[model samples]
Target chain A: MNFVGRQAFRGPGLTFCRLLVARYSSKTGSKEYIDGLVKGKPVVVFMKGTPDQPRCGFSNAVVQILRFHGVENFDSVNVLEDEDVRQGIKEYTEWPTIPQIFMNGEFLGGCDIMMDMHKNGELIEELKKAGIRSALLEKAENKD
Target chain B: MGVPKEELEKKLRSELDPAHLEVDDQSDGCGAKYQVLIVSQKFDGVKPTIKRHRMVHGAIEEEMKSIHAIQLKTMTPEEWEKLKPS
Candidate 1:
């Protein structure tokens, strides 16, 4: 398993530095680079296209799942934008798929797992652990 | 060019020994896309979902190279039964 596991919580300044390295470093798609890309982010996805206009059905499904949870403003990497990243991510995670989701720097599974987790309420629990309160929780509370 | 459904099925059956398996080629004649459901003991017991997926992907590593997309539903028999019962 190439699972990166959960990283320790980081301060905003340290997170900013990691993001900067992820964005500006020439070694795009390297292990260190991807680590930086995901580190400290509440949610991140390496998908086929931008979240607004996902090129693939699976990627679009992931976008919808997060949206239903009222999760916006998450980081997204369009693999189509960079060939190195396109291949590098598959090798990095050793998982053969696009639309890979990460939560708190841990590689959550792909589209199917996202859907499964959403269905089983695990997604909400995960977001809560990341200190994100899902909008669904609010809706349920409002119903009560 | 995509892989033949039978070949993909055979590979997964042999590799994972799934209790229940369904491989659907959603790409019509071209065979580029697939939706696979595998219910197996291999997916059971404290295994994270990501690891379960990796097990399936690893089984079809070669076919995965040429395939454009795959939608996978991997679960242990107990999990599968809860979601879909006879």
Candidate 2:
């Protein structure tokens, strides 16, 4: 892990991370761990690691994309930091993978889908359609 | 014990006599969520919602009782041919 990245999750003895790991590691308990996160954030990402310190390349891709669009307020739930979140998210979305993004209480798919939408400008379109009021898109347009 | 893929396939095929069926075992080793892409002549001019889902519901009968979700990609064979994934 990056030194700065480790510092990003220093609170609560990093017990939150450990709990997440344990949750995904086991099979049948607190399955709603992921649910609460999604409900907590209008834009929640269940990814390989945290946003500022993505542990995997896929999570990095999403972080980069969002940063490119000036999206800084999104919350990322690190899947690697928690096992229950890792497995339960897959079960919840039935997508069997990581780097999943949820927007306004809806599954927005993974990197491939997000990148595709981003590249084709569909991501902005859909985000607008979903009424996200993304300062990211506004900022991107302003800079352009 | 759960509604297996074979059961899903059989239930759908017998009910719809679909031109083609793709019943994915998306249980992710736990047997719950499934992603199905089905093409049937019976759905030649059907609405996207009813065409894709009700067809599966009609076929699965009992399995739909448990499968929490079904990501449907329903189309007529002609539509499927057009979307042949290049």
Candidate 3:
């Protein structure tokens, strides 16, 4: 009661409320937590929804593009589930969008970059570098 | 409410001084969605694709709050020339 009132008087009540929300939502939104989550993953997508059921078209496109390369096992974090994560990821990568990709724990840009890489054959080359054989490669070999 | 296309164009023009620039309002006249193609010397030494995107995002950071999505194609003038059907 007094604590809430004091915090409200100190700043905008909205910031206090948001801080409370973040405090109660576990520490998953922390930069260190996200850093640990991506450190060892070969491919990770911080997107709008789960890999199996992406909510946004851009996120869906990311999932589908990875699927096109036969990358089904990559990790995915649905930003829609947690507001903190949704905001944290944007700040972490300094990219202002959903559907952010990280390859070998490195920020790989957003869906547009993925689309460009897919079209330019860079996605396959990148997957190879990450040690994940793209299904397209197998299909091309079969055609030979 | 959403931002006007001309406002975004003006912002990009002043910030990037792009040699070639295209801004398409993908959300009809509503202005919530946009696709931008920018070819500027500002991107000449920026190698990473994400870094290029960050520069554009930085310029229009304010507009982004109201806009839902932006499909950006950012490149140096030389890179854009190679992409042209010549």
I-RMSD for candidate 2: 8.7
Worst 10 residues of 3 chain A by lDDT: A14-23
Best by lDDT: 3
How well does each candidate superpose onto the true structure, as a TM-score?
A: 0.86, 0.50, 0.84
Off by over 4 Å in 1: A1-25, B82-85
Candidate 2: which stretches are off by over 4 Å?
Answer: A1-31, A129-131, A134-144, B1-86
Q: What docking grade does candidate 2 earn?
A: incorrect
> Which consecutive 10 residues in model 2 chain A have the weakest lDDT in total?
A22-31
Candidates ranked by DockQ, best first?
1, 3, 2
Total backbone clashes of candidate 1, pairs 3 or more residues apart or in separate chains: 0
* Candidate 1 vs 3: which has more lDDT: 3
Evaluate model 3: give its lDDT: 0.86
Deviation in Å, model 3, residue A144 alpha carbon? 2.0
Candidate 2 per-residue C-alpha lDDT over A57-77 given as tens digits, one digit per residue, 9 for 90 to 100: 767998888777657767777
| Per-model DockQ against the true two-chain complex | 0.70, 0.07, 0.67
The predicted structure with the larger TM-score, 2 or 3, is: 3
